[model samples]
Target: MALLEVRDLVVSYGKIRAVKGISFDVEEGQIVCLIGTNGAGKTTTLRTLSGLIRPAKGSISFDGTALTSVPAHKIVSLGMAHSPEGRRIFPRMTVEENLRLGAYSRRDKETDDDLRKVFDLFPVLAERRSQPAGTFSGGEQQMLAMGRAMMSRPRLLLLDEPSMGLSPLMMKKIMSTVADLRAGGTTILLVEQNAQAALKLADVGYVLEVGKIVLSGTGPELLTSDEVRKAYLGED
Candidate 1:
């Protein structure tokens, strides 16, 4: 069974429907990416999957359990973690404090070990554990966001716009770490605006336009697609 499955998910804000009947799946250990421009509901889909926003219609299944009615904290314990858009790190909180919050759903004793793992993945965070997250650079904050999510020991990692605003060099580094996380056995469901960077690493890719998935394919196939190139990849 797929590690994460979303079917016919529909979400709205009062009168406006943001996500329209989208269905997708992420097999264990694969990078499945959702790509679209602003206002395409990419962030909304991630928010809904993470249980921050309830879907108006549809079902979300994670590792065989239905997640529609599961509360957000419960969803975290179910081994799904979301690193949301804008790298929403707490400005006043110390880096360690922010990371500790990610493990709040756990009742186990391995949080210290997992904390070490996050440090290993982001050594700079380790070096600055006592510093305020807001004092860090954008790239550093992005790393902290991902590190914080990793604190949950998630089976499936949902990353939204991991590369939203960063230097080209930092973006490359963050994207590589995403691949490494998959290599280490965490399935990833990614929503990114950097279509070229995202599709390059994705095993499967879906194109969302105006809240609907307009096309789907293997990453390379979509990379070669003329329509995708024209619309998202900055080609003719």
Candidate 2:
């Protein structure tokens, strides 16, 4: 069974439907990416999967359990962790403190080991362990967000717009880290606005347009697709 499965998912804000019956799946240990332009409901989809927003319609299942009604905090204990868009780190909290908060649902004794692993992933986080999260650069904050999510030891990782507002070098660094996480056996469902970067790092890619999935394929296939090229890849 797929580690994560979303079927006919629909969501709305008040009267406006932001997601309209989208279905997708992420197999265990695979990197599945949702790539789209702004307003395509990419963030909304991630938010829904993470239990931040209740879907107006459709079902979300993770590892054979229904998640549509699960509370956001409860979802973390189910082994799904979300690094939301905008890197919402607590401004006043120290880096280590912010990371500790991510493990709030856990009762495991290996938290220190996990912390070491996260520090290994982003060495700068270790250097700034006592610094306020808000004092870091944008890329540093993004790393902290991902690190915080990893502290949960999640079976499925949800990343939304990890490369948003980053420089070219920082973008490359973040994408590389994502690849490493997948290689290390974390199933990831990524939502990204950088279509090229997302598709390249993904094993499978879906193109979401205006809250609907218009195309789905392997990473390389979508990267070379003529329609995708014109519409998202900035090529004529």
Prediction RMSDs, each to the true structure: 0.8, 0.7
Candidate 2 positional error at 33, Å: 0.5
lDDT of 1 by residue, 1-236 (tens): 78888999999989999999999999998999999999999999988988999999999999899999999999999999999899999989999999999899999888999999999988999999999999999889999999999999999999999987899999999999999999999999888889999999999999999999999999999999999999999999
TM-score, structure 1 vs. true = 0.98
- Cα-based TM-score, every candidate: 0.98, 0.98
- Where does model 2 exceed 4 Å of error? none
Candidate 1 positional error at 56, Å: 0.9
CA lDDT for candidate 1: 0.94
